[model samples]
Target chain A: MITVRCFATVREILGCETRTLPPSSTPQLASDILRIVAGARTTDLPKPLLVAINCEHASLTSPVKDGDEIAFFPPVSGG
Target chain B: MIIRLQTADFDPEREAQALDVKGAGARVSFVGTVRDTAQDRRIEALEIEHYPEMTRAELARIGTAAQTTHDLLEVLIIHRYGRLQSHERIVLVTVWSAHRAGAFAGCQAIVDALKTRAPFWKKEISPEGAVWVPGQTPQDLR
Candidate 1:
């Protein structure tokens, strides 16, 4: 299973924090996972999400294997 | 020299004093606080969220990059996550160098880098509602 973590507005829009993807799609790319969930509320997700795999920043094209943890959030605004 | 992310507030003066450089003559420090207003709304608080390990990694990268650009003796960055009320400090950047030019530039570069590169995102809480700053509103995105 792949665990997808959402934050901030994406959390509010999806109404869920974590999504577990079954092993059938054992090795989906990060962008593909985002596409699947982005359908729930297409417009609500951040235009460009900052993604990370296992606490390390990653691009959407990054590979995701079963049991990997992924996170998505809006771009940083802190100073 | 030091970069940290914490939920608790920090004492800027105490932090500045902590960076002891024997021969470093110039030091510049920057402190950023939550504003009382944003998008013309009276902000009540700021709720910051960040990637745990990634935030640390990015901050360190920015600090190191700033250090490389100048003759810096030391650099410190402290950023806070979680809920913060208006006027509460959010981040601190301190740079120590042999000369004022390097110190000033280093401090500014670090702060600028933090604003864009760090993994932290803030949502402004006001009477209207909470909205992520510098981000498209849910309705707008819809």
Candidate 2:
């Protein structure tokens, strides 16, 4: 199993802190997870949201192993 | 070995104090503050968002990577969440190394990695509307 975390606007929009998905899920990579979460939160998923796995930015094809942690967030403006 | 995600204000001195290690000769620090203007828009405030578990893990991983790449002794990273006004310190990074170059390089790498890697996002609230800024590119994220 993998733990999915939503943050910032994504968290507020989703109304949950974390969600657990089976090892085999759609959009398996961390980026894909963001897409799924974004889709679930807003009627139309924003194109610019960011995704990270284990604190490192990951592409949509980055494979996620079992017990891996994933986080999804929008763009950042902090210095 | 300290990682924090808080909405409360942070003290760089205190954060620096935490980086005290026996073997390190130099300590380099980086503070990320909230800027007033973004994309030429008169800024008001910033809303910072991050994933909890994933953020911590990602930061730790980045710290580890920095340690591996550079001859660093210790590292400290602090990131704030929630509403923040302009000029507020949003993130703090401290690195201890045997030499200044290592510390500086490690610190820079950490901050750069954080920008592109960490699951943190920011939204600028201005007179016009709220817009999400594009994050680091995939190459930059790495």
Candidate 3:
């Protein structure tokens, strides 16, 4: 299984902190999980969101393995 | 070499005193504070979030890169997390060098690299609404 984590606005929108997907799931990149979560959302997901795999910022095409942990975060407004 | 991820506010005087030591002729410091307004919109507060491990690693990498690119003596970076109000200091970057030019260049380069590469995130809360700062992409790297 792969663990998917959401943060910031995405977490608020999804209302779930973490979810697990089957290892055989298709579209296994960090961005793919976003598309999946966004698809399930009632509202449109915000643009310019960021994705990370195993605590490292990752591109949309970055591959994910079984048991990988992924996180999504929106742009930072901090100083 | 000091790195801190803290929730408590920091004092510039304390940081300067701690980083200042023998062999350093110049010291450059940059403090980023939460502004009361952004683009004319009044901000009430800011909620900062970060991928913990990633943020630390990224900041350290930036510090190391700065040291390599410039002649420097020391570097210290401290950032606060959690809720922060307007006009409060959010981040502090300190660099010490033998010359003013090195100190200035090194400090600027470290901050710039952190902005572009660090995984820390921020969300502004205002009376009007909340907005996230746009994420920096690879193209933003200098």
Q: Which candidate ranks first by TM-score, i.e. highest? A: 1
The DockQ of each candidate is: 0.50, 0.38, 0.39
User: For all the candidates, what are their Cα RMSDs to the real structure?
Assistant: 4.2, 4.0, 2.9
Residue lDDT tens for model 1, B31-122: 99999997689999999987767778878877898999987899888999999999999999988999999999999998877777677778
- Residue A40, model 2: lDDT of 49
**Could you give candidate 2's per-residue lDDT for residues A1-79 as a string of tens digits?**
7888766666777776789877764436665555555564555433465566666666556778788877666654333
Cα error, candidate 2, residue B100 (Å): 0.7
- Maximum-DockQ candidate: 1
- Write the residue-wise lDDT of candidate 3 on B52-124 in tens digits: 7777877888788898888778999999998899998999999998899999999999888777677777888
Candidate 3: residue pairs that collide: A76-B122, A77-B122
Cα error of candidate 2 at position B24, Å: 1.9
Please state the error at residue A79 of candidate 3 in Å.
3.8
lDDT over C-alpha atoms for residue B31 of model 2: 89
Q: Native contacts retained per candidate? A: 0.55, 0.39, 0.32
In model 2, the runs with Cα more than 4 Å from the true position are A1-59, A62-79, B140-142
Misplaced by over 4 Å in model 3 are A25-27, A40-43, B20-22, B140-142
Off by over 4 Å in 1: A20-27, A66-68, B135-142
Task: Please name the candidate that would achieve the greatest lDDT relative to the true structure.
Answer: 1
